[model samples]
Target: MTWLFNNPSEFAKEMISGFVSANASMVRQVSGGVVRNTASKPDTVAIVIGGGSGHYPAFAGLVGQGLAHGAAMGNLFASPSAQQICSVAKTVNQGAGVLLAFGNYAGDVLHFGLARERLISEGIPCELIAITDDISSASADEIHKRRGVAGDLVVFKTAAAAAEQGATLAEVLAVAQMANQRTRTIGVAFSGCTLPGADHPLFNVPQGRMEFGMGIHGEPGIRELAIPTADELAAMLVDKLLAELPAGISRAKGARAGAILNGLGSVKYEELFVVWHGVARRLQEHGITLVDSQVGEFVTSFDMAGLSLTLFWCNQQLEALWFAPAYSPAFKVGSVIKAPLLATEDIEAPAEESVAAATPESQAVAGQIVIMIERLAEAVIKNADELGRIDAIAGDGDHGIGMERGARAARDRAQRAFQQGAGAGTVLQHAADAWADQAGGTSGAIWGVILNTLGTAIGNQEKPTANAIAQAFSQASHGVMHFGKAKPGDKTLVDVLLPFSEELTLQIEQGHDLAAAWQLAARKAELCARATAQLVPKIGRARPLAARSLGSPDAGAVSLSLILNAVGETFPAVHPQGDTLCL
Candidate 1:
């Protein structure tokens, strides 16, 4: 477990500060991650790459002259906020455009997309590319759905090299996209990771067993298998990547490729080198020539004992770019001329946010909403460990942390808005944005959508009636489905939410008051959530790892039901049995 930390919430910030101080000669501190200590070519394209913080060298360590110009580092196992990305992009961008790239995860996609829009609106040109190179996440026919793993290094380097060559923004984008297309990677984990201040690891691998196709964020693998020897493991990885050669590579014979062997965390250099020896021999046996092969940890998952193999099926152009000189904190390709460091002046201040006052009736309602949110926060924090344990069964084990962090943020934001005399809708609106921005995952984004929808339905003029509340919940369900592309029976939170919405509406129609209706609907949601134990996931990170979760209820579904139950308890409703017919 990651035991050494003071005030876990400030871990990422402190890590960034220390990282900048250590590498001040190369990287400078910025709002999000780091930018080059030295200024870049005046009109050159800026390559900004980022993701969560745990992947050390991948993000901040790559910021330098010949590599990434900047990186937007997020909290541990979470994507950076749009505001963070925007700040990094603005600082690094000169007259030329910015190329924003990151791993292909839901939170990264959402935040990067929003940042791109904001930059464009501010008259700064921006481009985006979500690397999708993990062949295990999706089939070849749907490669776009794949996750970006260790192969991200290849794509980032290729793009950064092109930019260093003074390539136009469009040209840089083209080559980056090409690199992504030609790259394929697969990973296997022997165990899972432990975040700072956590007592136990996110997940565990049985002795003498390995989990194949594991994600970098402590997500359980697609399948678990008995451990194999180094050579056998190498062959398994090589054969898989070779099975689907990139287009234009007719066969392994007479083909040249770039190889990257990445140790996830606990896997040592000796272990990787052993695997690489077998990997090289296998390729040579197949008549494939290795070009500029790299063996080390490029991307990591904290202390997870895992390794990934990335094959960059290269042609003439890609091979040439692969050897480009680069200098950074962790990565170095070849020699490069050093440039003078920029002055360590202060960065720009973050934009200010404010809310306007609302009617007194709506303000009173906002106060109540704050109290309810406080209860939600307390409940989530108390049960965070249990939530994480459930999610580790199949999905990434950060659900507990994300939920706890998001609920606390929502509570704080709602309280601030209430103090500012905001209405109930505006209060929830603030909470929604804070949750999504603070928590940075599928759950965070979906919860944001849910609350925002309810905010829109419940206007600022008056207190919401039972009918209004029921309708708001119904609309919120639709919004969640639309935003997340999840449906009922998918073993996601949607399974609980949809039925809860329907029941709430039914209860109100049956003449039960808001207090009674909410409690009844919460019970229904709890039952629906428990029923998900019999279902297999049909989408999201858990889908590929479905078999491992057969007997476990969906973590998100359970959390949603818990939150509903907690909120329902905030109101008094005395109905032990069904009341006599009101009609």
Candidate 2:
């Protein structure tokens, strides 16, 4: 039930059927399981691209006009056999010769290289261009030997463009090499992907942590770190790529490099834009002019919660060819724009505001609240795995990890603010900022908005009471729902929150005791959370899985209930005064 496939054979057959059916006009299924695009110009140089199937819009989907002439599709994460590669070469050949290009992976190299020998025996000329652009996967001494990631798109397109322009096979091979040499990519995975039909993931990543430089086929990454803000992650990726650029390019071109921000499947476009903003800022800081840029799911690892960054050091020839119009299922030219010009003053903006007129006592309380949030972060980390599992049942299986990781990061800043003795409002604001910076998803962003709103509502309030808390929650709930676009019955965290807020407001208006009011609200939240089982999800990743969730409560709602229960248990003096709390 955890996996989506009936078996490996079925998974592979379904993929092949869907690929050919969807792309029949562009590609034709040939003998020995090869798919050759019908539009490949006979007199033009031939470019053959292939790899495993799961990284769609990659090895196969990209085979079309101004791209690969043919693609050898393999089973999920498994390279195609030499016979399949040969079949594609024979089908696409038109006396122009073939240039074999693919990611620098062992199995692919073996199969493709063997196919090259077969093509030679049949009197067809062949050459190889292996893409090894992932800078994070290897040291400087080993980078050329590392596997390719998202940068393959750049390589395939650059070479294909040259071929389309009537260049001979050798010329196309040279351009492809130039593309690979100028390219570098780095990726981070928030969660591992499952191969089709497999119950368990091909690999495992602990909740709330990220693996940098993970391979497309579920290979382990070079490093594991606490995920940072979209901006921070973007900066980190860009910085590493910049450091690896050819020595003379930055000095000679002086900021004329190009960048591609690619999603490795399952990442939303909005999130990619946020990350791109960070990348643009970081590159600007280094005097590296982003000559051109692209954003989308170019290459993906079947539902992997990750992204990759590719940078290409471009000269006039490459830049001209890069912008030349071409179309494929995954890549498009002319959509890239020249990097924007930013001023030094904008880059060096002040980080702090003047608060000299504020009272010392208020500042001290603010600092204490910051410290409390940091202390609470440890609990978030401890519950990360359980939370991740909960999310997996009805969502992308990342909420638990995302919240835990983000909380832990925010806690670091909170602790520092507390040590400085900041006021409660100041502390809350700091935590909110840090949370957004550390967690780069919808839930984390929502949590940040809530904290920031709570800080504003609590400012200047002398005695915090149940009413004050209720008001703060109500304001926060409004902000979360507004940003997330979830209504109470949408099988979201709002399922628990909406009822809790309404009941708490009612109890406070009646002058009920704080504990008793909270107890009643908690009971209402529990019932609401359970009620989500009868509702279909209408938002986020859960919508597609909602039918299967007919008897299961939304993960977000369940987590909300757990959080409320935990709060009630941890603060017994504030616990409600009835057996209704047992819900």
Candidate 1 — which pairs collide? none
Give stretches of model 2 more than 4 Å off. 1-7, 32-37, 247-253, 334-583
Would you estimate the TM-scores of all the predictions?
Answer: 0.86, 0.56
lDDT of 1 by residue, 1-583 (tens): 5668899889988989999999999998877778999868889899999988888778998898789999998888888877678889999887789999999887787678767877999998999999999988888998877899998988889899999899988999999999999999999999888888878787788999998887787565568899999999999999989999888878989888889999999999999999999999998999988887889989998888999999999878888887898999999988898888887563455567787667788887888888889988999999999999999788777899899889989999999888888998999888987887788777887777788788878867877887888999999998778656678988999999999999999988998877788888999999999999999998888887788899999999999999999988777445566442210
Superposed Cα deviation of residue 59, candidate 1 (Å): 1.8
Best by lDDT: 1
The per-residue C-alpha lDDT of model 2 at residue 152 equals: 88
Which tens-of-lDDT digit does each residue in 379-428 have in candidate 2?
56667777677666655565675677568767776666655655556566
lDDT, model 1, position 367: 81
Worst 10 residues of 2 by lDDT: 339-348
Q: Per-prediction count of colliding residue pairs?
A: 0, 12
State in Å the error of residue 378, model 2.
52
lDDT (C-alpha) at residue 2 in model 1: 67
